[model samples]
Target chain A: GAGVSQSPSNKVTEKGKDVELRCDPISGHTALYWYRQSLGQGLEFLIYFQGNSAPDKSGLPSDRFSAERTGGSVSTLTIQRTQQEDSAVYLCASSLVGSQGNYEQYFGPGTRLTVT
Target chain B: SQQGEEDPQALSIQEGENATMNCSYKTSINNLQWYRQNSGRGLVHLILIRSNEREKHSGRLRVTLDTSKKSSSLLITASRAADTASYFCATAITGRRALTFGSGTRLQVQP
Candidate 1:
């Protein structure tokens, strides 16, 4: 793709249900990131994936949150037992390899996840 | 603490007026960048300034950096209604490859 792409622009889910947000990064991009933004708020870091290696899941916020990246190109953010506090716009971004290369991050339109 | 923090969480000005937003970070960085996000839309990269560079300009955007203070400012000249958006500052530290973003400033331009 010419830029990063995300699915389900908006999702309304019930509490305790699990939801998966997908991210398809630009072709050849080596680093992918997930961020969450509340209404009128700044981005909250969620996860970072580089290549096929382990991801920096430090920002997942809790045990209910998890993510996976396949083939180093596509990534998914999964939130289990969704809570109202989890409602936010989940954004995906891609950039050239961080340590190995450098470029501005290309962001996706994001999926607005609402937990009711 | 988050590496970057934006000042003046919100700003409102008449169209054609200039807008200036400032950001302060806590750690040494490899580079600092700016981005703008319209309501409910994806963020658009604005400009990036390296640690060694003091200033940069592109189109109507002007950015100034002070490494000693770990601060940066973005100035938009002759701002227009189209510039009404939330602005954010992000920094990628020398050791941390992922960019850390600030809370952001919401700028409103009224005609």
Candidate 2:
């Protein structure tokens, strides 16, 4: 089966520029999530979408960061006016929401965003 | 804030030796999961242990969860050089869908 996939394996941009990263979750997956990982650091949750309900935005570091999942399939994360601090590997993952409490997540290769 | 914190930021061992990594979380969790990442790209799921599970085994991997102590441990027996990678522990909070991951342990296995 096809796993999650992300576009633009690597991106380099200047500070204050905007960038959009895309993710395609596995077919039939209802939950999608985005996370950021800085060099030698842990993953920081960004946002999550489940079914048609409201997306969880608690983890978004600032207003400049936003994400939207359309048709319950693909998701895009947009960073407006990016900052040097925003440079990191953006990872996307998807999983099936099961009756059980927790489910393992399948990840994408990720897009490394470099803000120079 | 990060919930899970893995001990020993890095580790090195010889092939065929056993390796163990530990993780500690701050809050109650529904499950704990281990993931392996190669070259800092995609992460592959290794195992998952529910809050009620105290120990689970898959192949040469053993995972133990202690809800009382808010900690978990992953033991890999008879490791191989190919096992060298970054291992991370992630916690699914009691009511949260998103997972909180630890900084990870960089494992180096010499053949």
In terms of TM-score, the best-performing candidate is: 2
Off by over 4 Å in 1: A100-102
Q: For residues A23-99, what per-residue lDDT tens digits would candidate 2 score against the true structure?
A: 99999989999999999988999998989989989999999999999999999999999999999999999999832
TM-score of chain A of 2: 0.96
Span of ten consecutive residues with least summed lDDT in model 1 chain B: B92-101
Structural similarity to truth (TM-score) of each candidate: 0.96, 0.97
In candidate 2, how many Å is residue A52 off?
0.4
Give the distance in Å from residue A64's predicted Cα in candidate 1 to where it truly belongs.
1.1
Candidate 1: which pairs clash? none
User: In candidate 1, what are the lDDT values of residues A28-107, reduced to their tens digit?
Assistant: 98999899888877788888888877888888899999999988888889999999999999999999886722468889
Using Cα atoms, each model's DockQ against the true complex is 0.60, 0.67
True contacts kept of 1: 0.48
